[model samples]
Target: MSPARGGWVILLSVVLAMLLSVVQLPQGTPDWLAWLRPNWLLLVVFYWVMALPHRLGLITAWLIGLFADVLHGEALGVNAFGLAGITYVTWSLYERLRMYTRAQQALLVLVLATLLELVLLAAQLVTLGLSFEWMGLVQTLVTAVMTALFWPPVFLVLRWLRRHLKVV
Candidate 1:
């Protein structure tokens, strides 16, 4: 249960998510399975930040965010700043967050996910001069919903790994 091993798990998950983000699934004229890009990286980082705050702190979050930026071809440091901020906020609330039930945890995740999206949108708007729209909010909301829906499975996986495989 060392932090190093936990970092590896998180790093692998992020990389996998990045690969998944780009894989095109064809169903019609447009690609299928394109909508599942529901902030998988954010979810993974949030999981570790909440579950293993002592191990994966803001620094790790920032680094992974940068990596995500490179992989996604997003503006440089956009994900880095947003993720670092979200991780810091989550880490600040870790003690209280740890006390919540799964349902409550999902709610918190929803809020945090929205925050992450907002931060990304804002950063892009500022740094890249991108125009903001209500759809961005909707997309973020969808991502939040997806993150909430996906939390239980992720939680179960990490819990099992923590118990069986030794991840800090």
Candidate 2:
């Protein structure tokens, strides 16, 4: 039998992720708090790729990252390259990742998100001659913390959507 499909749901999730990537904070928000903002697009892409590897993989991540690069007004392909790495790592380990407990998975997310930040930072340094800031590390830590905190709910919801839509 053929695997089920949920193309529209996947598209909708990706669009929402892109929108979240471009969302602005309130004017009075502190710089530290702003830095705590999670990488929503990365999280969404990770979730979908983990849950549906056969359906979503490197190309989807690269395209989503490209759109995000445009939305964030960053160097084109920065996010694409970073997300492609995430997809590769995730694709390689999807089976083990699925078998992991939530806490273990969150730890993995932390590592992956940190790697993504490092890749982007490295790219920026190469092309823009940007100096490293301690804040960048802090931001990476916060992104991981947020990803860990958010993963359970997001996973549950996506799993529900997949089951409801009969996506294989």
Residue 2 lDDT in model 1? 31
Q: Which stretches of candidate 1 lie over 4 Å from their true place?
A: 1-7, 29-33, 128-130
Q: Per-model C-alpha lDDT, please?
A: 0.78, 0.82
What local lDDT score does residue 64 receive in model 2, on the 0 to 100 scale? 81
Worst 10 residues of 1 by lDDT: 29-38
Candidate 1 C-alpha error for residue 98, in Å: 2.0
Clashes of 1: 0
Put down candidate 1 lDDT per residue, 1-168, tens digits, no spaces: 433565567667777777766776765745324544567777777778888788877788888889888887778888898889879988998889889998998888788788877877787678788787887777777777887888878878877877676776
Estimate TM-scores for all models.
0.84, 0.89
- Per-residue accuracy of model 2 over 1-168 as CA lDDT, tens digit each: 685577889889889877776678888878677666777777788888888888887888898889888888779999998898889998999998999998888888888887887777677677888788887667677776786677777788888988898777
What TM-score does model 1 achieve against the real structure?
Answer: 0.84
Worst 10 residues of 2 by lDDT: 31-40
Report the Cα lDDT for residue 25, model 2.
84
